[model samples]
Target: MAVRGFLRGIGGKNAMPQGASADGSERPLKPIAMGDGATRLQLLDEFEAGGIGWFWATDDQNRLIYLSPAAAANFQVSHEELIGRPLTSLFTLENGEDEEAAERPLPFLISARTKFANMTVKVDAGGDPRWWTISGKPYQDANGVFLGYRGGAKDITADFERQRDNTRAAHFDSLTGLANRNRMTRRLTAILTAYKAAKRSCALLMLDLDRFKAVNDTLGHPAGDELLKQVAQRLERIVGPKGEIGRLGGDEFQVILPDIDDRGDLGELAHRIIQMISQPYSLDGSRAIIGTSVGIAVAPYDGIEPSDLVKSADLALYAAKGGGRGQYRFYSNDLKDSAQQRREIEEDLRDALSRGELRMYYQPVVCSQTHKVKGFEALMRWEHPERGPISPAVFIPIAEDSNLIIALGEWAMRQACEDAAKWPADMTVSVNVSAQQFSTDSLPALVTNALASSGLKPRRLELEITESVFMGDAATTDAMFAKLKKIGVRLALDDFGTGYSSLGYLRKAPFDKIKIDQSFVRGSTEDDNSNSAIIAAIVSLADALDMETTAEGVEAMDELALVKKRGATLIQGFIFSRAVPQEEVLEKLADGNFVYEPNGPEKQRSQRRTLFRRIGVIHEDHRYEAVLRNLSRTGAMIEGLLEVPVGTDLVLDLGEGQLAICRVRRSQDATQGVEFETPLISDGADGLCTRHRISPYALAAAGMPLAALPPGHYAMPDRRGARPTDNRRFMQVDVGMGASRAA
Candidate 1:
């Protein structure tokens, strides 16, 4: 059958069905079939209208029997020009590889009769290689001669180029043109894994610029940006190919070295980085220099995980910066321990403040001349349930470094003020102020607030500060001190002699009192001319300034006497008492003996004694019948077996209470010490009285009778086994009317 019309050989008109069915209805109509040539023409028209590129070739040859206009357009040629041309002719040999000839056959292409095959073919265009995808299928007439294949070709050069660009952008840093963090992380992971497997080591260095903020603030951001770029470039040069450098952001950078022979190599690199960055950099015609502090965490030495290693490096970096800038530090176990401890302490401090675990103790500072309590120094005391008492020496510095000192100082001030409100109206309370506390602008406000809240008079509160507090900017210190002083709060230069005591500052700044350093007090009476001179000078300076001086750590009578002679008006030390707790302070107050008593005969005697003569009393008192409680040349404390009347004149009885004469020093309780009217008889002859009128004969008579006296009447021999005995049996004595006896 043949169909020639557009309607496929349809009838010229609506023709009646050839077969008729029942009820006058047409049963069906048979359509005519088209020829193979007609079918082929229809497919070609569809392909051409759809803009699809097509090619048909036989396995026997690479030549194309049919080619669509779209396919020819891909080759920049007309359909007629490519219709009989071989497919290989469209693509030039890339890389000079040989191409199949048009007459040759491809076995793989010949076997594919129904299925389509796809392949990439390289095409040359203007000396540049372009890629294309070629899809084709073998075709043949049914039970007849073999026909060529037919498929499509699409250009993929742009897709390939886009892919290549994406890869490059993913792995590199665009700014410094070095590997980005992502690439460095991946490389580090692989390197670490390899190192672990091989049992090797490596190091990671983290560095941050020191005082970079100051530079950035003084200069412009643009200068800072340029400096960073230059730093990155310098780092790259230093690291070269041996290691990888990466900027973690801002002024922080990191370096990773694999298979490091020694950790020192990293240290050397760090030192170099510090030195190089520390060199002056010109920014906007002005030279700026900045240092770098580096931290190094070595693999297998610091940690196994990348994050852990980085954390250690960061901790070490902080340590370097904290230990003063321009240094490098290695990660150590102790550093981790200290870090952990600090974190714990910070947490504990917060909890402690909330839990009200902190308290203050008061030590009374008294007036030496008036013997009246004038003030109390507030000392911080921590009583932990498990740790017992923790010293401020251990935690105060820590608090300052962690910035907890501000809060702690505020708390302490409030507490001291509250306690001061409870103290005697005339007694002031002084609290030590830390240097860090002074740094804050709110310190004066804090003091004012504390006073207002506690309802305590500002005049009743004193602030104790060390010399170091004023060692900073002169103007700043002066301003701060002036403001504080204007508030009616007394200021005392604490530990005055220990620090840079520039008396000029003392003169300029208005201080109400100077507390002599304990160090000077501890050694002032050692008979050292230098110490004595220092004490004298301090006292003189205080006098010249019309400032009250309080001598601290006066542990002995000589120290007290020396400070007194130097005209120190106030004294604090173990000689009187230690810094007792609040409860104990009242008890010490009740016991009032610590108050200096100038009129007291015992005290007067103690002050007049020389150190050498004080020791002599213990040697000579074998059975002089006295227990030397406290001794001095001019006066001594003797607790005797016999009670001496308070106003009695008595002989000191240096030799068996017979030769030496002394008036009965005012007796307190049962203790008595007499001042010798004359030097004791030291003559080797049997009981010769050198000064006192008692003769050797009288000593012999008294010794014999005292031997029979009751134990209560005489003092027992001391541990040295010396008993009161009359060696005067060999001599005679002369009694005089001026001589008086104590026993």
Candidate 2:
């Protein structure tokens, strides 16, 4: 309507009269009553000069023939300089802020000579970003020959930028500056859908901060927020462009790693994340240390859908935390069962101490030079009435979570002190103190009571504390150390190199010894590893501080020899002795045999996971049931295939879509050892799994509905339409028929 009203002055039918209409009296002229071409041109020039809107025209070649002086000034150039410049060159289609609006490219619209209205575009003025809404129509001569376009445009930069800010705030975490929960979910869903078509893979990682609640409770929520910000920054540095990380609120974070399915690489990255996050954080003049447990799942292998994948990763994360707070686990089908069993374990553990299911075992920490027992580290073990032995690794974290560790730890400490008083006077006992137990004020009083009740000298009761104890409140930690030192009980730093190692704290904390973690000891003998150097540095640091060093988990003579050579003052592992029961400790003390000889394997060998589970053995078209007795990265042992040739190739159907191609390296009667064609990778736990699995999409293409891999064997359907009648060459023996044969 406004344009029509303005156009009336240019000789349109609605033009008003300017003067008297053939009468004596004069008539009032309309505001824009232009009776000549010069007046109409003057009005148009004034409109352009007012910067209300600007006109532009292009020749048939889409080159700018004329632009209003005001609009030309917006580009910071003279109108003459912009003349003959390609109109499309001066303005480009806006980045697709709105998908529908950018569907038609600017060049395509101009070349097609179509009428376009209110198209959002960016003006290529060499300054801050400028956005405009342009409306244009194709013009032509009376003969219908096209003469390009005439358009008017107005700047919308401010409005467009404001809208973009709103979009960003909606999709991103305002505090961490990372994508928020909504954005991460949408991104994961989109990537999985796209990757499903391409048959590619994406790995999802779910991590929950360990002991984060303690930080909040101790230092307040503001400090917790600061700690979270620091954690986000660390994650960004580590993940960078490899993946997208998002905080799912509170202490939970998720990472989406595209094109990454290999568990080995994922495990490495997860370990790095755990290590980096476990380091102490300085927050508002207070120190807070925290750890993370990560769980990983890969697309099509773990699950085909977003929810399933997330659930799988979450299950893995639960397992990691349950195993121990500072670790990572990859998804497996058994985790669901484990998750259920964990809840039961937690319930059972609440009453374990009263039921007498918990007992203390002592592993000897020997003198490296004399091979004599110097002291013993008291370890806790659980023996469920029906389930028998339960690993501390499986139950300790549960106790910590359930707040049973304080009571349980007190019980173990008292028992250790009582038992140590009866042992040879020269020998000492070391009991582990958990971070949860140390955080309470009752620890020092409990230690004092344990010593007084057992009549054991305070020096004989060594309390081993991990690096996590230094998490928050440095002054409090120092006070605790002072109190313990005043009580005359020795303090040994346990798991020294397992992340959170800081020389700054070591300078003041009164520690009597440093226990090198098993992780460093396991690979110290390898020529390619730097574990040896790390061990040397730690031992030297301990020696300089007038402290002793104990190399933990030395199960091989070579590892023991390496640690001893590197000047470790003590050794504690299977190389000397496993943690013995109280009865055995008493029996050994009566015999007066304080010396322990190195009794492990002469050299380190590849660690193989020992288990007895049934799996399928496939030969040609026949699949026979067999027992998988044990498995390693490179090979496995099986039974029930009688007289199979040693060199014959076979496929081992380890269920859940995992198939291992192997050749029988050794065969004898019903027993055979096979070597894998491709060595399996770690399953992020204490097991091996194939790096690649039969995808669920492929299963769907084979007439099965798409879903997460089920617990049964996945075999190719028989396309021959009939079963082959070939007789079996090898007998399927019942290896478990030992009772009948003996009868």
For candidate 2, lDDT tens digit of each residue in 1-743? 77766866595765555563534357775575556788899878999898777889999988999888888887877778899999888887775433323266777888889889988888889888788888899999999999889999887888899998888788788889887898889999989998988978899999999999989988899999999999999999999999999998989999999999777789889989998999899998998889999999998888888999999999999999998778899898999999999999999998888888888999998999998898888999999998889998889888998889889999999999998998888889999999888988999999999999999999898999988888868888899999999999999999998888999778989999999999998877877999999999999999899999999999998998899899999999998889999898888778888888888888887787787888888788777878898899899999887889989999998998888999999999889999999998876666788877777777777777777788888664442234665676677867776321210
lDDT of 2: 0.87
Stretches off by above 4 angstroms in model 1 are 1-346, 586-743
Backbone steric clashes in candidate 1, count: 11
Q: Which candidate is the best by lDDT?
A: 2
lDDT of each prediction vs. the true structure? 0.63, 0.87
How high a TM-score does candidate 2 get? 0.91
Off by over 4 Å in 2: 1-47, 76-78, 96-104, 716-722, 725-727, 738-743
Deviation in angstroms for 117 in model 1?
A: 73
Evaluated against the true structure, the overall lDDT of model 1 is 0.63
